[model samples]
Target: MASKCGLLLFVATIQVLIVAAAVFNGIRSGYTKVPTGQFNSNIDQILLGQNSIERILWDDFQKTPELTAFFVTENPVKTIANGAFQRTPKLERLGLRGCQLTGFPNLVYVHGSLIELHMSNNLITKFTREDVHGFTKLQMLDLSRNPIASFPDMRYILPSLKTFNMQGIGFNCCLPLYQLKHPVLVIDAAPCAYPDHITDRLCLLESRFRKFRWNHRLEIKAGYSSSLGGTACQEGIFGPTCSH
Candidate 1:
């Protein structure tokens, strides 16, 4: 009988998974929990870390133009209105780390598909050149551990910048950081820690706030708030309360 029908089809007697199939019915599909600190995702990235989100208006989120990364780290965010990602035309990474911003918000003159613009540990103090005249395709610009001392004209609006992290920004060691009498060397390498001791990784010049007596004109200066939407940190002192 053809070897007993090939041993009864390998003892199955008919040939198959012995008729006890269950390719994937092990069941465990019921997930829906993402509410603390906020979440509105399906992968296009929008972290919203530690949210108490002060402001980013424009209906917060859901204008996805295939949104491409937009975090609000350690949120207490002070401002960010003007088309807050304005239907994210493929926003290429834009985080506001440890918020309570003081300047340079309005999504950097209308996101030009930013390629990483962290705004490190907020409470920012400066940023000029018409506030980054449209970031001309920015490429990694993390104003490390803010309290910044105004910068812009990065070769005139980041003409495709390639990493400019002002580590713990503190340049005004007596206002010489800029005086343009033909003094062009603001970022041929962009790495700082000038006046007071600063740190946020390597540029650290030994500073535990160096014994807190540094008001060298507010080290990174930005008490200049005539309120055009910037500066905020008194009300239980928001996040990044002058970050370290």
Candidate 2:
């Protein structure tokens, strides 16, 4: 009986030691090397290469309060487990570009300190307003080269968003400009190859013009009156006359 009790205590000690080692490794991993391009003191650039499991070891991150930015691209995580960021309330920037994610992880929703999110070249189909409801400080979001057809109202929800990349989404006819509050410098608007492929997209603009709402009408009228140019509309040029 005495030996059994001693063995139990030894086993518990080993478990505690293992946990402590994991936490130490996770925190010390960031100090190995600094990432290239864009450095901020407020952000903690972490390169997670050893993590094979779906969840980020939140238990390790919680110990380091100063840690902010998470750069998990070197060894890109395939799937993020839920509650992965529960302890990481201070994390701001997250770079999961080319992680091969089909959907935004549940862990992302819990953190509110997120300001910049890089999710380019993922398998994400669409992002609704509710999916990103809590990220009030989000400024930069990259959703390039996804199958996203429907988009959330960017103007209403992500008011602070400055750079929005929807390059290869393949907008069929027209983009929903009515959903935007301010005129953002939208990249790759002519995904359908406007003017070049007239048959496919020539009448596309006309169809959008016919279905213009009150806000769209006001924008069109304002553009026509402005010194910028005539035949101006949200989807770049109004027709062949307005094509830049």
Candidate 3:
């Protein structure tokens, strides 16, 4: 009996070790080659991982000013450093999955050009309306598998956003998605505790807006902004200097 028990234990330990080795090898095989000195000049898109030699190389970015897409996954990018993307003005698509980043990097320079942002499997907690208001042309946003608890009104901010992915984040309140006129595909409906209240508010808001002119309808929250017949003008959705 004792020999049989020992044999079973040894087999389980061997299985665990085999799984761990396989995972390690898989990660190693998935690494994309970082551009070398001469290879950096004309590259428009690059896949990066922890072993990327150019991770901290600023000159590489300067050489590739027209870089449009950047993907960094299955690794931890400790610091993106200020002005890292200052020269990549044409950057449109950015993916930072599994980068261990706590928040977004400073991409103020690329705000106007960025269209798709994928930050899945990071440690992000929140994304206020103001955080994304500047990306007017932004179309797709994937924040799946993050730790975000709540997000502000998406309609008032990302009016042009088409694909919004919030799967794997556990939210407790209903998102005000009615304000978005553009066709948007929302993934993962929020699991709210007060379903009745949320449903009633959405119903009332939608019904109230149906009576008003489309141009006159502004997204609003209670006691948050100046109301035209109890409908407050949505904030932070305007262009620079609130021109829009």
Candidate 4:
């Protein structure tokens, strides 16, 4: 009886390891070429995970030199294109939390004066050290709600970071989060927010579909995916930002 129990336990452990590896491999697949992004030359930024061409929005925004803060309420800003700062070089605060972003925005910087960046509540899944390495003066960053499998060492990358919020985040697998100081990152904290799989296999699915959008008409949670099947996934689809 003891031998049989041990054999079962070992098998379970192996299966768990296999899934974990797949999750990491998928997320790291985009890093094969060591992106010569902000880390190389006079660079600083990201964009929707897999999106390539830069899309612009709000043409009038190009002349707001005095605008200290940029925010969108119910409108839901999808991408913060490079033109967003063509005229305004000194943005002190940016609020994109709870918006519709599946990946990081490749930002071009004229100055690193941005002090507070609110990016929690979006569907951002992939993040790395280079993402924020250029935020030389960034003081606070909010990355909550997005189901990130694991966080890379953020100790020194953000030199001026005083507070980091990652509440309501996702996990690759089950986590013993009782020891976590920021209980807000708990997947079960909110009801009907993200689908059950978000908390179950967050990492495994994070990199699966890099380009996706939210269909407001559908009765589904904001970050929920339609591919999983159910009445809430009518528009499990995404293409160019304008295709919506």
Worst 10 residues of 3 by lDDT: 235-244
TM-score of each: 0.27, 0.59, 0.59, 0.47
Q: Compose the digit string of candidate 2's lDDT tens values, residues 135-213.
A: 7788888888777765765766776778777766655434444443245435452454222333212122355342221
Judged by TM-score, which candidate is best? Answer: 2
**Alpha-carbon RMSD of each model:** 19.9, 13.3, 14.6, 23.2
Tens-digit lDDT string for candidate 1 (190-237): 233455553222111223211111232222222222121233211111
Judged by lDDT relative to the true structure, which candidate is superior, 2 or 3? Answer: 3
Overall local distance difference test of candidate 1: 0.52
What is the C-alpha local distance difference test score of each model? 0.52, 0.54, 0.57, 0.48
**Residue lDDT tens for model 3, 91-130:** 8988777766676666676789899998888888767776
- Arranged by TM-score with the best first, the candidates are 2, 3, 4, 1
Better of 3 and 4 by TM-score: 3
Model 3 clashing residue pairs (backbone): none
Best by lDDT: 3
lDDT over C-alpha atoms for residue 239 of model 1: 11
* Segments of candidate 2 deviating more than 4 angstroms: 1-43, 49-60, 74-76, 107-111, 180-182, 193-244
* Alpha carbon deviation, residue 51, candidate 4 (Å): 24
